[model samples]
Target: MKILFHVLVSSILLVSCGSSKQLNENKNSLTKEINKIYQENVFNGFAVSIVDEKGTLYQQGYGFADISTKKEYTNNTIQNIASVSKTLVGVALQKAQELGKINLDDPIEKYLDFNVSNPNFPNEKITIRQLSNHTSSIVDNEFYLSKNYYLKSNQDLTNVKLNFDEEQVFNPSDMKISLQKFLKNTLEKNGKWNKDSFSKNAPGTIYEYSNIGTTLAAYIVEKATGETFQNFTKKNILQPLKMDQSGWTFQDVDFSKFSKLYESPTTLLPFYEMVTYPDGGFITSVNDLSKFLSELIKGYNGNGKILSKESYKEYFHPQLSATNFIERNTQNPYNESYNVGNFIGYGYTGFIGHTGGDPGVLSMMFFDPKTNIGRIMILNTNFSNKKGNDAFYGIWNILEKYQDKLIK
Candidate 1:
């Protein structure tokens, strides 16, 4: 009996060692495959992370964070992750609800100090749920591009060529104003900076992506929780998850670690900020985002810590139906506009996460519910042409191919 037990233990140990060896070998193979694609040079600097509910399976960065300085991008390199930042707003809303501060069904006007009714349907009440699902009928107008962006206070605009065609205009840094003032002016009835900010449809009747509407929802969180949006999120989301390297504004992070954004492999963009930051501005490293994604996976699995499991369920619940979209994106498997839950999005092919693009930035973060595995990509350069698009998806596809092997 003693001899049999010894043999059994030895067999288990041998199998375990073999499996570990195979996993490490697979990781190396994944790195080599990804590195090959990186040679295409479609983006200046980018980071990719693969994570499971337990933790990160793999995280890496490639290329130059600063080409002139010869600074290599690493997992700790930080950049603003455009609209992917909206997911944190969703999480923040759920946390506030868990604390009994607000309800999703409440009319947004209840907590607002200013009026914001659709000009076409003044009496139709817009609910918080509508904003979360992109059914509020609030549209980002031309002013959204023309007025929201401002250059960093320190940037010297001596030789920076503003791309008007792309609506990449950066106002002088001193013109940067408060979020409330910006939203109130853009969203209020006949307020300054207001244009065609509302669609013809009634509130909660159609899908219209509204960055202003999202910022308004974040403002509502401030009113209900009696906290600044930045502080509230830092305390409830960042602190709880230990995302020390992420922040809503420039002041909260180590600016030295921030990556310089690119218009092309050779053209650099001046640092800038948006007045309606809640809509897209989130500064973070791939390492920090990997931690956040892992928590989201855990939340989906009903073992999360930041918010109750019930809140997580609500956070992931699909809120839009077929009628909500006039034309749903069926071809693009990664299109987040197909559906929305809270502030996060559901892709056409059932991926849950969000995608964001801004001046010199592109970001995508999604997780498969069935597999409980997630992937994230953040690029410092913009991609509009087919070659860049293909290369972007190429890295994502390679990660997908290897995620299963790394899943333990």
Candidate 2:
């Protein structure tokens, strides 16, 4: 193992010469495969970064960041990372633990002013770990706060789908004023689905992938430290790690460097106005996100910029049963991803990542704790049910096909 204590001392990166030739060959192969995929698919733009414990091995971008001005997308072009932000929240809580603010295994109610409990399982108290791993048994409608809710059975790991009427759409403006405020309403007593939202299944037993579960976790961090999630993450994770190109809001980023989003190759999508910001509101660049990913790789190797080595292991540990991850879940596809090996494989981690998708976005961020290697990818366009071998999730498949080849 190439354990470098010097990385702990400074952010100055080291590159090993062992696989220089193969690394170049892998890069060439990846570029060709990626080009072929993007050429055949209708994508506005995409950015990707690959890294190990030492530093970034490859970072690149394709297509146009701003089609109006014909600006070519590059590594610094920022985009809203969608649900991948959950991992950021997970890491923040780890920092909160280091600061003696909260414990992952402790009941989440202890951190909040409001009582958070599943009414069906009233006596059961949810823990921070469950929330992080999506086994909290708190079902999320991710839209309306009432009705359409179900309990997570230990047997189900896929995200639960509710029977919402086609016309019964939701508006972000109608939700809570802030993410913290939203959690208070959604997870507390007398709240919209206070009773219905809580599952009969006990907390820490079932794996129901939830955006609300993670948003609540972020709120717990805020309650424990008396600070907003954005400010806390900026102060502790982003700034400390020197991910200067990343932020939780518009004010933290350079508008000129931002990539315009799209619903399709030619269709446009507005920038995000987040009601549940903590769940999917992080905006960052391949360069900045690479720095964060690099630190995580370092953390798994027992050396990190912000989170301790132990925290890294704990945060990335699998939260579901082996069978739950042996086959990928289509419903909660954002929280985990697998290689294109007939069956999707988590390769030792189902919680280390949070893939993202919306009108015009398809993104992924994942790392293997054992090998200290990971990837961050974002696309400004969303393609569905395309007809080909590498149609929709080509980026993931590409990385999976060459993961070992690219990792030095």
Candidate 3:
């Protein structure tokens, strides 16, 4: 009897060891496959993280964080994670709602102190839900604001040669001011924009994917909390997640550690200031972001240290279907669906997050609630045209290859 029991115990131990070996082998293969894609794609700076149900299985950084300086990419190097910042803001709004500080259905006029000039929209009530879903009829006139501000500031430079069409200008500062003014104006006008000027779809009817909507949401968070948006996010989101490396502003960040923002093809541009930090203007590293995703996957409930599970669910719920046009234009083709604050996946893996891109940055973060698995990929480079598109595709392909394992 004793001999038989020993044999059985040995057999069980052997099987367990074999399974562990297989897990490690699979993880190594995933790392190799991702590295191959990084090598082939010529991505200037990139970081990828894959965490399973147990814990982080693989996290790696490849290529240079700064091409000119040849600085190696590290887990701590911060990259601007454009639209991914929205997920954080969404959580903040939900928290405020739960605290009885605001209501999702509250009108913008209730919280904001500005006046809108457009006369199309009816009913002075633009609800918080509408802003969160991008169903608010806010016209994003960043280009117009940029042009007007530039021409007004550079009146004497009219004779100076121009790169884009004289009519096409990109003014970062003016874009921010325009959004703030528009939000303030919308409140003052009692939510009266051109009827047709707003989307025909009823509020929260369909997703239009407007950065303006997100900015309004941020403004609401600030007004309700009586705190600056940046401070609110840091206190409510980043600090709780222990995401020490993330920040909405670039003021005190150590440039030596921060990944240098690159402007594609070889030129490097300093990070452009974004007025709409709520939409797409936060910076973080893969290591810190992995921690954030872990909390999200665990459905943190803002209890002791994390966001409320209820708020997390509300953010990931498919409030409305994102417009096809917006989906097609997204940085990740795999991100074909949209939720309230996130993008839903085709499978039953729950919600997959969105990606963000700008002149010198591209970022993606996705988490599966059911499986408690998540992945994040961030690259620094403003690939001029198709190059950026191709690089993003390469990253998506890498993520897709491991989707089953990552989402499991």
Who wins the lDDT comparison?
Answer: 1
Model 1 TM-score on a 0 to 1 scale: 0.97
Q: In lDDT terms, how accurate is model 1?
A: 0.90
lDDT, candidate 2, 269-381, per-residue tens: 55544566677778889888888878877876778878777777676554566443334555543346432110112433332555776545677777765566778788887
In model 3, state the lDDT of residue 16. 86
lDDT (tens digit, per residue) of candidate 3 on 361-402: 788777665555677888876565675567667665676577
lDDT of 2: 0.69
Better of 1 and 3 by lDDT: 1
Candidate 2 Cα errors over 4 Å, as ranges: 1-29, 142-176, 193-195, 322-352, 369-371, 400-408
lDDT of 3: 0.64
Per-residue lDDT tens digits for candidate 1, residues 166-234, read: 665788888878888888888888688888889999999788888888988999999999999999999
Of the candidates numbered 1 and 2, which has the greater TM-score value? 1
Q: Give residue 196's lDDT in candidate 3 (0 to 100).
A: 29
> How many residue pairs clash in model 3?
19
Measured by TM-score, how close is model 2 to the native structure?
0.79
